[model samples]
Target: MNRFGKGLLVAALVGVVGMAFRVSWNALRDVATATGADETAAFLYPFVVDGLMALALVATLVLTGDARRFALRVLAAYTLASLVLNYVHGLVPQLHDEVVDWGRLADWDPANWALVLLATSLPVGSIYFGSDLVAKVLHHRPIETPTTTPNQDESAETYVNRSTADLGVSAPAPITPAPAAVALPAGPGVSLVKSTDRVPVGAVAAESTRPRRATGRVPEAARSSRPVRTAEELLIEARKVTADWSDRELTAEGIRKAVHTSPAKARVLRDTLRAERAAAREASKQAARAAGPGEAAA
Candidate 1:
């Protein structure tokens, strides 16, 4: 059986058991009331039924966790035994008073009898077939052995011998490194040819030891105020580009009218412009500083 079938089986059992509880409760309550018992005794029926339900629920969780045929069988047996004992306890002449009358054939109380029958029936039925039902749902099928012909052993040995001889199971040879080459970087006004072949470590080391070109081109000064762009300038430019309209107001048409240049060019121009302004400001400040305090006061 599959999960759906097993689940349906368990659900059916629960329904039957739950109906038994309802029957037991009503029967016990009516019997207790007829006997003029106290409120406590009358309440015992629901308490006992609910207690059994809680016990069943706990057992179900524990048994389902382990999920073995033996575990389920034991659980079913436990429920069966409890149901039988509870039924017998309720039905025993000593346990309940017998209402007797002379010269009368009496019916066994319908309510009490029905409850007793239901309680016994559900658990007994469950125990007899429940384990097998659960096993079918959960157990793996058995594997079968194949019947072999007489010549099978001889054929197998012959195949193994031929396979091993063809395989040539020997150790492999060690690997060797490739030879290296020398290369140079491109120099100004000289047509440069790019090397497709990789230069080796030994050749590279020899080239590094040789005299290098001393081209007299001065590098840009790091400390020079030469207009420089900062992150702040880039963000300011982005804001200015969007300043004319709200996000919603900037339709595709409005955006097309706003800027004709590509974003890349705009970014480069914004950075260069910011740097030039900074350099000019720095030059003016330096000039003012060179003039001295007396000149500034005048």
Candidate 2:
């Protein structure tokens, strides 16, 4: 989800958790008071609190894809077991001690011990919290190699050296010199695109006279770098050319027809497009250098 949606969802969850906490606390307090239990004993309510909390956390994290599904499943199962135990204990209080001796048809129940262990030990919560902390630490930790074979390391180095040699490169290779910059040709037949400044009159006129090609041809590097009509200016020229033919909808074919060319040739004209872009970049850089210190500061 986008940022706003995520924020709204988190806010809703926080509200739900806050409401659940208040409701659970009041219910627990009422139960303790009726049993004549010490109010201080309510401090141990977190174990039970955790049971419900685990269930909520498991459900929320699972739906949101925030936590591992396996961990959430474990929490969910534990919470379900706790819920069943509470229900069983409340419905059949005698079952809390009714352990049957099959041979004698007699019983010794130990369910009360189970309830005490569940409440005091907080086994599920302890495991869940510990696992979560460990997971976080492991997630951020740089993983170390679990095993190392000397031969594998040697082979890796050998492969690197071999690849460099095959490419006619030396290990720890030397840097190469950059190519010389070409000057952009100027005058009546040249166009330049300077994004940082207003379009020039010379560029506009050059673009108007430049012919559109009709087929694809890989432009020679020299020609590719040669200054030609700029695209923005070319589009303006095209707009003027099409003004007479504007009654019809224009397509690639329509534009080609107006230019008396094919789509393949138009692709070749892109070399001129590249040249214009390059010239524009050069112009912008020059403009930047020419700006006064105060202008740059501003």
> Who wins the TM-score comparison?
2
Q: Measured by TM-score, how close is model 1 to the native structure?
A: 0.24
lDDT of candidate 2 over 34-114, digit per residue (tens):
333356755445345445455546444434234455456656655665554445435543333333121111123465445
lDDT of candidate 1 over 1-298, digit per residue (tens): 9999999999999899789777666555544434444567666744443444454444444443334445455556545644554555455544344352321112457754564455434434544544454554455344467677658977788678755654544433433444453465757875444353434434321123223455586566734664555656644654577655454554444433454445665655455445655697899999888888879689
Task: Give Cα-based local distance difference scores for all models.
Answer: 0.52, 0.52
Find the candidate with the highest lDDT and give its number: 1
Residue 217 in candidate 1 has what lDDT?
67
Question: Clashes in model 2: which pairs?
Answer: 97-109, 98-109, 99-108, 99-109, 214-265, 215-264, 215-265, 216-264, 216-265
Please give the range of 10 consecutive residues that has the lowest summed lDDT in model 2.
Answer: 99-108
My TM-score estimates for the predictions, one after another, are: 0.24, 0.32
